[model samples]
Target chain A: MENNNNIPIDDLTEEFVVNIGPQHPSTHGVLRLQATLDGETIKDLLPVLGYIHRGIEKMTESLGYKQSIYLTSRMDYLSAHINNQACSLAIEKGMQIEVPERAKAIRIIMAELQRLTSHELWWGSCAMDLGAVTPFFLAFRDRERILDIFEGNTGNRLTMNYITPGGVMFDVLPNFASSIKELLVKVKEHLKEYEELITGNVIFQHRLKGVGILPRELAISMGCTGPVARASGISCDVRKYHPYDGYDKLDFKEIVIDGCDSWARYKVRMEEMKQSIHIIEQLIHNIPEGEFRAKVKGVIKLPVGEYYQRVETARGELGVYIVSDGGNKPYRMKFRAASFSNLGALKPITVGAKIGDLMASMATIDLVIPDIDR
Target chain B: MKSLFQYLKEVFLGFYSLWTGLKLTLYYFTHPRKEIITEQYPENRTTTINIPERFAGEVILPHDENNKHKCTACTLCEMACPNGSIKIISVQEESEDGKKKRVLDKWIYNLGMCTFCGQCIDACPQDAIIMKNSFELSVYNRNDLVKTLNKPGSKLKEKE
Candidate 1:
């Protein structure tokens, strides 16, 4: 109490710091953020990740191409399909394998569905972060249908390693088309309801509008992608920029909002879900009938070279960099997570924002901590 | 004084957003009878999965009434397991014709180490291993988890 600002006399200008999590609900999952506060405003913030790091990259080097798909599912549990897609694509590209057209369409449908599912959950969870509990339950309600479809096809709900290297692990069931089509309509209707519920809500806007603003320049410098970068008016969507798995042929808009705030991020994802549904709808009737898997060599051995592949997961750009040395296993595997780049932008945006605003800002970043840690 | 109106508009806008959220919750609460999506899991235990099933669970080798298990002691499951969860000890015994026929001495499956990846089932060449839907795998003791599939003298008198 030596100074009027209640700063210690020795450290008069310096701020007090509080560790936000390794367990806090605000963190989403085991993310520790050390925030230095000057009064109510965040002066400086440092995000401490790797508490949940299980050496997934090191584990991948030991596992074969097929075995590594299961490990990829765990890295970003929310968007396992995307993780699996990236890994499978890397192996497919490395091995120069040709996946069937029917398989490509199926993979696109599943990937788009996963994007919608991930965004829906993100929207609901982000709302919950701002103390709106209703959207969380509503989002899960829609997510249940997606999980049902996943269980119908892949036998697992969240960790769907359905898509494999040569093609998908299995073909879409006969009823899968009708069920997914029905889900598209339901998701669309629910999305409109969600618009009324959260998007147009007054409190949501107040909490989000012009808060946690990341300018286009800063976002580019940090290499932020997905909704975070999109919110800041940067067109960095991997699906649009570099199309994979028939995404090039599909008709969909890249949802971008120049608001550069939490609201923009929310808006981007909400619109992206609609676009995902649009892509899913176009692929429904035209699901070509052909062999699901192509002729992959009995044992996969990548020649000595490096291969890189990226896919737009719900969080952001998921880049898989693989180094092979004429072996069955990858010599080295590196994952450039979307969340890692998004989280890097956090300190710049959080500083000068209130502590309450910090939570809103972090939520807008849409981090999957496992993706960051992995 | 003009800024006051703009400030008030923003304030009203914020309140309207919150009200919209509340209205949604109200709709769900009122529409409670609209197909309760949550399955009462433990109570309603007979939840059948959709077809083309990919349920990753425990591996069980089918046994007939005479207790003849399908395993031929090939040890392919042992080779397939990434964690070395499955172990097979082959017992060679002299048949009626004096030929040394291979039989499972002890089929050791450590549930603790198993990932339930169904890799063992995929590796079994004899169609011996099949993944059962019995997912209730929790046990009190770690020792109880090490399940042995084949015991001695449990083989059928005549092969099918």
Candidate 2:
């Protein structure tokens, strides 16, 4: 058979290529990975993207300031509230409108609650990716309670678009604090169950412990943020660093771990979930007795200039940049989505790891693809 | 001997961890009624449906029993909609006082393109449109989603 084959046998190497998902369960969204493998070891990994790009930034150019805020929620849907808040804060900065104290408190509370929900889903899905399915169910069970709180307070669940230019769309419901307190009670009790289900599992730990090690310099060069960067000894939590929406007054810890592995990323999020609960507890009791929304005038027009605002979403720092030419619609809008930058660090860390370990590393990075594509 | 001891330690810890997780699973399997959270959606729709009151399912123009709406055909909602999901068709008619008044002929909402962002409800100056709580909005045909919200012969409500 070797003699009968075509010429130039030396030209062909032992390595072959495998494509993992434009539609992969390993990827949280539509992210495709082209991996050159020698046996199970990935030699080169390239991420093929733009499967779900809707050109949200270009579309926002035609829409008014109020209408543009709604489009940001579509970018990173897991942290949709934070995305909306980033856009709203940018608009408020450009217009020079002071958001009311009550609105600021309400914004922080919703952002924290959403952070908890996003991390819970990440915890569940990360476990599910590693072959333990029960944790996903448990995770969803915890997440539904927070989503219910969101639905009752905001008109919608995912794309509420409740954060407007100067303030929030509606005031908190009477039961907002009571229901959150009840949710906190349940979440604290179930965290132990989460510990039992997935955190302590021997197989899960072995799979994640030393896989996909990203160094601190590499993480900084790649511009990685949120839990991914925090795992690698980067203290880049935007809430702690920049302190938007009165995060300065709140008591919480920024979680940073030096493991520089998938396990560290997972641990950072788990600790941050506790911190989120702490922030909510601080604000839930003392929502200021004032207007939930500042009076934003009709047809919001920013002075002809450039405006930029950054907020730490559950995934990472989301920077909203708007260029207005003294008009209702922005002349140009750009969303520096966190996932887009984090996805770049994947290939650098996963190049020599086995294919099975790729899932653990990728899951820990926690990409929501629309954010990347946008 | 050291290799054997390390091997035994790993095996023992693995089984212990799996067993602890399995115990919770066994407890759940024994008492599913207390622990079960999922609903079998389509089959038990009548029995277990619990949509929240503030859910923004679809945009609707609410009318009173007298068949009167509050729309003045101002077209603010049309302008406010990010994707042109709401279309207001207006016609200028000579009123009883001989003034040319633009009246609402049709308020069309395309649910297929809607993000359910509630911008229309927020932009409505007359409070004519409200997002209803009925969320089972799927249909067999896409064309069926384009609904005319204003009823035939519905007139504008007089100012209080």
Candidate 3:
């Protein structure tokens, strides 16, 4: 190795620094990674964030409780419904308002549909990251159906601020049941296609099988949640442990796998899509008839205390914490986004792996940059 | 001979997996119309696309044939807006009963900064403003986005 930068020849190491993205597609969003590489093997990795931070938490402190729910949707845009739901749950808990049963069922159905859409997008993008283009097209085809359903009812497709403080914004559409049943039938058939396309492919399996192994202990210590933790045999599903939004009334299994590798993470998400479908199927036909929103005061004021609410988003557990001084606006607002903690596990998992394996490990983590930065 | 047999078995299994993946793409490729997902935007604008009734495209002030509106100049929507997109200007007027009344002079809606969260519509007590399903709000100039929602010579409707 040539001695550059006037370093002592005897003390110089052969490792070279490689900067991967403030704009790379594989990072999923605007995230910069400083990777130290000795040839093809990674020695150390550091994730540099704050490219897409919009000061969402600080902004929420100035807005009223009703106005703050809309801002959470932009944090995890894929899991927009769940992000809004977490904020609303926090406000509802602070106020001690009992949400209507009909609204609870509707919230669960929307959250699960949002989960399916998010996972389908993740599957397509993750496959595309690994050099498979066909799955991307197929995945988006199915996701469009879900977006259309959201647009029809919520008035917006991506950032649907449908879940309010006490309950949902509006009642389910007249054909909500029939439309979801039709989509579920199509999604079930297409899931088999996903299995054949990528799950059984030998090339993909070789790339993912034991690439970046995250041990169960390390995952828990790192505060990982959702499919990433479940893949490592960590039973930290918020829906199961906490059971908010009528998730306790539903029958579904938390998907867990012990492989603790990129393949395990992929399999966990695939199985989660099925569980989401199962949950939706149980509640679709039995939507109760009642008012969608509870009659709370237009100007909602929280009690003078601290409140924390956590819900299982498509990524992981999203916790919304608010401190109120019995005011219209919150004194302090903070979000424990899953991508932030999940991003921490990156360096530990990818340190000794190849540069190519870095992409695979990141694909499995499914980092959405705004969620991390916020 | 045993090593060679093991190598051949591995090759056969790999090919089988590859074939399984290819079979799905071939099926979609053959059924083009059924599998194609995207809509032809602008080209099929009127025929294929239907903007849902609840979609929050742009804010509008619904007016009657008599050029009367329902806004009472309460500025509730302005207070509820997180981004200050809605600005209501009120002018005090003396009514025939010798009582002072606040009348809305202008309702300026800035389309640029709007997040379309529908908070303004929810906060409007008089049901004067609503989100219309006309999403084509693109304008050539930034000033064009700042629209005066109330009509030129309209008056507030009498309280029922």
Say which docking band candidate 3 falls in.
high
By summed lDDT, which 10 consecutive residues of candidate 1 chain A come out lowest? A1-10
Q: For residue B56, what is the lDDT in candidate 2?
A: 89
1 against 3, candidate with superior TM-score = 3
Q: Which pairs of residues clash in candidate 3, taking residues 3 or more apart in a chain or in different chains?
A: none
lDDT of 2 by residue, A26-68 (tens): 7887889999998888999999999999999999888899999
Per-residue accuracy of model 3 over A89-182 as CA lDDT, tens digit each: 9999999999999999999999999999999999999999999999998999889999999999999999988999889987878999999999
Which number leads on DockQ? Answer: 3
TM-score, candidate 1, first chain: 0.95
TM-score of chain A of each: 0.95, 0.96, 0.96
Q: Each model's interface RMSD (Å)? A: 2.6, 1.1, 0.9
What residue runs in model 3 are displaced by over 4 Å at the alpha carbon? Answer: A1-13, B1-3
lDDT of 1 by residue, A1-374 (tens): 34466655556555789999989877889999998988787889999987999999998788776677778888888888989999999988898888899989988888888888888888888989999887888889889888888877776787766777888866778898999888887888898888898788776777898898899999999999888999999888888889998898988898888899988888888888888888989999889998998866545788889999999898889999999999988999999888888889999998999999998998888888888898
Q: How well does each candidate superpose onto the true structure, as a TM-score?
A: 0.91, 0.96, 0.97
| Fnat (0 to 1) per candidate | 0.61, 0.80, 0.90
- DockQ, ranked from best to worst: 3, 2, 1
Model 2 chain B poorest 10 in a row by lDDT = B31-40
Best by lDDT: 3
lDDT of 2 at B142: 88
